[model samples]
Target: MPHFYFHTENGDCIRDDQGEDLPDVEAAREEAVTVLGEILRYRGAAFWETASFSVIVTDADGRTVVSVTARASDAAPEGWTLQETGE
Candidate 1:
């Protein structure tokens, strides 16, 4: 099994364990996106304008395995901003 660290641009962090049969990096990337989407929805910002959102997937050795950047849709509203921050 492999442990993956999901770091969000909004400074949220989560850890997930992928089974030994986990797929390739592309599959991991997709999972990361879906996880982030769930987070956004939970925070009531699913339809908000979001840009520069990113996911960093690290292996057990703490090395980056893959990174994914999320972009807003073409119809994103003007003057929208992501409220992610670090404390």
Candidate 2:
């Protein structure tokens, strides 16, 4: 089992485990992005056009393994910037 840390652009975070059945970093990242989209929708923001989100995958010892950044489409609302820092 691998531990995954999901970090958002707005300072939110969550943790979960990637079981043996699904062991790829990219696969885990995709699932985290999906969860992030749901979080944006719950916050009354646009998941595909207004919200900018990202994820930092880390191992149990807090070592980063991968990062995934997702931004709203090019037609996103004004004043929205898709930037992330601190991996």
TM-score of each: 0.50, 0.48
lDDT of 2 at 46: 46
Q: Runs in model 1 with CA error above 4 Å?
A: 11-21, 44-52, 71-87
Instruction: Evaluate model 1: give its TM-score.
Output: 0.50
- In order, candidate lDDTs are 0.62, 0.61
Candidate 2: tens digits of C-alpha lDDT, residues 27-79: 76776667666766686454555456666666566677666665656586788
lDDT of 1 by residue, 5-35 (tens): 6656644444455522345666767777786
Q: List the residue pairs that clash in candidate 2.
A: none
**lDDT of the structure predicted as candidate 1:** 0.62
